[model samples]
Target: MEIKNEYLRDLYRRVEKRDPNEPEFLQAVGEVLQSLAPVADRRPDLIDWGVFERIVEPERMITFRVSWVDDQGKVQVNRGYRVQYNSAIGPYKGGLRLHPSVNASIIKFLGFEQTFKNSLTGLPMGGAKGGSDFDPKGKSDMEIMRFCQSFMTELYRHIGEDTDVPAGDIGVGAREIGYLFGQYKRIRNTFTGVLTGKGLTYGGSLARTEATGYGLLYFLREMLQKMKHEPVAGKTAVISGSGNVAIYACEKSQQLGMKVVAMSDSAGYVYDEKGIDLAVVKQIKEVERGRIKAYAERVPGAVYTEGCKGIWTIPCDVALPCATQNELDLAGAEALVAHGVMAVCEGANMPTTPDAAEFFQKNGVLFAPGKASNAGGVSVSGLEMSQNSMRYSWTFEEVDRKLEEIMKGIFHAAYTAAEEYGCSGDLIAGANIAGFLKVAESMKAQGIAY
Candidate 1:
């Protein structure tokens, strides 16, 4: 997309020049900048204040080394990163991803998107993201613990309940969060809600586990009703990924009267002509810690493919890419469109490539971006933050109700913003503009020091 506004164009140019090698971060920035031309035209004073320039730059970038001993008693070293992208709204809040693919570019991209995502939630949380290049696969429990301890040794100094509260993402799950929190407590000698996604015995919120998946459907429901004048009932859906997000998303889709026919993991995908059996999926993924291909073996008449991306070829009314970034490319979008997909709501961060998302919107498919739809997980994280501060937790029903309301509010906010800015029904533009306005205005109000 071309930046029609010269000021926004120059800002993007500077970002490109400074981070020439950071494609992911540059793509994120460019997407937001492409949507802000209307805002730039309306608010010339923001341009004068250099808000766009400052927003593109991180407030702080911390990198450290993590050393731990493996089961063989040999030492291993990995690089860790935390990019505190923005704190204009409130404290830095995002997840700590642990994957072999982790790097400065991925962290920065996630953090930049987090800033807007947090804003869309209408929470006081700002944006930040951190993670390590350490791959937790094939490691023993004790080895994972040692790695977590060493990672926190350096990270404990930079994070707190009010400073930055890190949650779980990707490879960082309940087990990882438990390990990370334990190390933080041992090092600090004090227990606080410095981290979300803790175990239920601790301060973790009741509905936090199901928040993202449920929230995606909540947002999708609103988008369908408001844009297409249709309900989610009777819609056949295909969701990519069989992890936490995908599993819960499948559960929620079933609850809402939709048939989720297919799900995938890194190795391959499983397709069931009938609605997916959630119990079997949970057992295979959560309990067994096995590949998705196992799903086909356990469930009779189901077929398993050997490639993850092939999952997109299935026909469905709704498509939720709950996997990783860029998992759904232009080809996937074309396949979905050809199959007459009505909506594409992201369950993972930037799961749909820009071209794929563009194709969806251009084809009159109702597309909800991850920042708005996937805000559910973080919405519950924000709720968990509140519960931690008060030393109180809400019931499962209460938390679920709150999450539904927040998702609905996010949809309307983006919808209204798009209509108000003359890009009616363009949720991509609406979400970017709405989220950017809040943070941009907050930055302008606080001056350039932030």
Candidate 2:
């Protein structure tokens, strides 16, 4: 979309000129600015306050060196980063990702998107993200622990329960969180809710593991019911990635009577005519840490494809991209549209590319942006924060109920905001506008420095 608003155009140009090399961050900023053009026409005060300018830049960007020893007694080094993007509404809250692809651009993009995701949850939390490029795939437990300890040695001083809280993402899971938390505790000599996604024995909340995946279906259900008056049951769905998000999303889709016929991972995808066997997938991904292709070998009459992107070619009524950023491109969107897919809801952060998302919208497919659909993980993180502060925990049913309500509220907020802003049925605009307005108002109320 072209930026017709002069104020937004100029602000975007400044961002482009300042961060010429950060394409991911530039893309995120451009997408949000495009959606806010309508708001800029009505709210001139935001331009005067320089909210857009400040919002695009991180409040604090920290980089440090993490050095650890391997089992071979060899010294290894890695880079760590924490981008405290915005805290206008509350303290910085986001996840700590660990992947070889981690960098300044990706971290900034995730952090920028997170500000809105946290806001859409109607929770008192800001947006921040931290991670390292350390690959935990083949590392032994002790090796991973050493890396986490080294990473936390520098990170502990900058985080706190009331200041900034970090959780797990991508490569950072329960084991990684435990190691990082242990280091933080040993260094600070105090236990607090500085981290979420902790073990059940610690500060983690019930239903936290399944929050993002389950929350996604809730949002999709509301969108389907409200927009088309269609029920989710009996619908065929395809989900990508066999990680935590995809696994639980499949589980919820099956529970809702939707047939999840296909699922994928980095290696490949498996298509089962009889619908996916969740137990087998869990055994392969969670228990054995095996490849997705193994699902085909175990399940009768299942076909396995070599490439992950080919999973989109399969026909389905609903398509959920639960994979990483930009996993679904224009071609995938076109294929889904040609197959008569009704809705596409994101389960990962920015899983759909700009053109693909636009294509889905143009083709009458209900599209839900990641900032809205994937906010479930952070929503539960916020709940975990509350539980930790209260020194109490909610039952799984209680937490799941709250999660369902939060997801529905997010859907309605986006739906209503889009309609109000003359972009009815365009959830991208609605979600961006609703989430941005809340943060922008809070920023304006707190003054320019905030």
Q: For model 1, state the Cα shift of residue 2 in Å.
A: 1.5
Q: How far does residue 271 in candidate 2 sit from its true spot (Å)? A: 0.6
- lDDT comparing candidate 1 with the true structure: 0.94
Give me the displacement of residue 249 in model 2, in angstroms.
0.3
Query: Candidate 2 — which residues are off by over 4 angstroms?
Result: none
Instruction: List all candidate RMSDs to the true structure.
Output: 0.8, 0.8
lDDT of 2 at 292: 94
Number of clashes found in candidate 2: 0
For residues 326-388, write the lDDT of model 1, one tens digit per residue. Answer: 999999999999999999999999999999999998999999999999999999999999999
Q: Write down the lDDT of every candidate, Cα atoms only.
A: 0.94, 0.95
- Per-residue lDDT for 141-244 in model 2, tens only? 99999999999999998999999999999999999999999999999999999999999998889999999999999999999999999999999999999999
In model 1, the worst 10-residue window by lDDT is 441-450
